[model samples]
Target: MATFFGEVLSVFSRAVEDDEEELEESEEDEDILRELEEKRQVRVHWGPALELIPNTDHRLHCPHLLLTVGHNASRFVSVFFLSRGDWDAVGHVSLWNERTLQSEGSACVLYRHRDSHMLMCQVDCFVAEDQLFQWTEQVLSSLEPSQVTVLSDCPAAEYQSAQPLGTAPRLRSIHTSACSEPTCCPPVELPNLVSGLPAAVMSFCQLQNISAVVYQCYSDVRSADSTAMDTFRPAVEQLAHSLNLDLCPDQDVLRKVISQAAVQSNLYI
Candidate 1:
């Protein structure tokens, strides 16, 4: 009985989305978009917390937040504005490059944006390594939506390698490489590379200016004997698994993420 209704609703939802897409692409709607990418929250950071810019809309409705998935893709990144407890099927955007996240690590950041009428939240994470990425795919697929939202993979220039936290020391890890560009530099230390989950999230939030965030980290502490790094695929997957097993909080877990975000805001940087 429940399954029957669920299936029916899903079919209807798909039809509506198809209609909306058509309408948006219609000649009349194209003119509307040219006027103002108004509801478009893609590039705009909700705030320092969720990387969402402050509200630019003037609608009076419900309180909700947006989730932006980051990836290597080049097209407009998919962004979703969701209400609290919106575990229903989500969306994914096109990913231009999948190989990017397979190498380094990225921390997820949550942000809170306020306006005269409403408050919103936004979430960010790497596509390849984060468990939420899987959850999103599954949920969106279940909804029978036309496509999933995927953010562009963070390019090499923007990529930051997260190192093993507890196992190795930070200072000793960074070293200079010779015979290169004039700038000639050593490995840059990434705050996201730290071992402690709290520290990583804190660093990510601080870096992105997203006031609130929920992130759990897994660092690869390389061994001194061999000096070669392990493949990032398995390392990142293992860490993501560990984070899910530990019940790490995310925007999906509002009470906890909100509480933690508050604490992070109050922390004495």
Candidate 2:
């Protein structure tokens, strides 16, 4: 009698599982597919200078900070901090070309701007080999809500290769010709390129009339979440809060990433 009852219970469970699977197949929602398509982020290419002008609707919000990812051989990437109400350039930060960074072995550039309510803004950067990946999250987390747009991947092959527009200090980098190995150029040895960085950066803040702070966060984690990365979060969050911006992330998703990283590290070690 006991065996017979157990057999009957197993049969009922199997039947219920099959019915639920069928129900799931039959009730699949089309709206979810539509939302997925609607929520996709579009990539915008800035031909020369990195353009960060936002969509018209976004202008109604606060000021937006625009970022341009400099290519390995691209010239100074232009950054515009635009005022939402008037669409005027409140300030800007110009970045050195990639070749220059490789030779200098760091991310250093000159920044200058005007003075206004937007002065003393905060900027935190995650320098990576490729900017397109996780770019949306980088911009969102680093900038004010609805106040960050990016212009990346310009076509120009080399920075300063083309006669640049003005007396803007030209950025240079080491390059390898097809037939030759890597060649290093004599450093341009500009003042700021040497020791004037803090002053130069501060000049931009002063011109914009706002106090500013810039954070350089290392790209040590490949995934969104890692226990090791958690240490960096507080500082990243603090930087955003200083700029009066909120930081967001899916904690559950991040935790999974961290767990995976731990497992992978254990396996390798």
Candidate 3:
């Protein structure tokens, strides 16, 4: 290239400018990914009740930990135990993902018996697949529980059986080696695997050598109903007795719980 003054100038390739722009774009993409990863990380936040507990390590000490995953299980616990007003709000787990609606302490709530060493956690939100393990780890790492019991819900179609499934919900159980007591239901068959948060909790408990049992309920309905919630009553009778929870809540309480759920799920309202 030459200027008007007749001075020769070097010509620069436009490809170099294009390469620089591509590099900048790549850096920006990396930054966005890092931010998303950070945002997706699962975290546990303890409530003021836990902070006031007189423990040297400031950790929640639980003799028996009960975890309920999915809407049916959570509602079952709510209608049976929580309705009795014997529990105190302890803490919650927070996570962000595409399906997350309320990351602020409402989705996954932890409760403790007002007079006993029992702890219960009800997870009513949709946890992303990738965040399940992290959510399990962070939530359980803060507590020292001798026995862990998980109640999970699934569609009946997921169950692998030669015979046709009945209308009633079915229960299947998977327990860790440390668990000595027999389960109320049969073990989940091979090739029919459990996934999501329930599986993550079971795996973590097995690796940590904690006595744990997971009761998975397979229901025909897509949404939570009274029948599906009542299906777990027989399976959890012994646990309810041990925890001194009301095995059969009043009809008024049951109606209230079911009505509230119906109101929330009503699309036409």
In model 1, which regions exceed 4 Å deviation?
1-86, 98-210, 214-216, 221-269
> For every model in order, what is the number of clashing pairs?
34, 13, 0
Which portions of model 3 miss their true places by more than 4 Å?
Answer: 2-10, 52-58, 261-267
Q: Write the residue-wise lDDT of candidate 1 on 207-252 in tens digits.
A: 4333322211122321111111111122123323422322222334
- Model 3 misses residue 247 by how many Å? 0.8
User: Which candidate has the top score in lDDT?
Assistant: 3
> Over the stretch 74-146, how does candidate 3's per-residue lDDT look in tens digits?
8888888888888898788888888888757899888999877688999888889999888887877878899
C-alpha TM-scores of all predictions? 0.20, 0.23, 0.91
Each prediction's RMSD to truth: 21.6, 19.6, 2.6
lDDT of 2 by residue, 105-223 (tens): 12322121332222222222223333323333322322332222222221222222233323222222211121122212232222212112222332333443433322221222333
lDDT of each: 0.28, 0.30, 0.85
Q: So what's the TM-score on candidate 2? A: 0.23
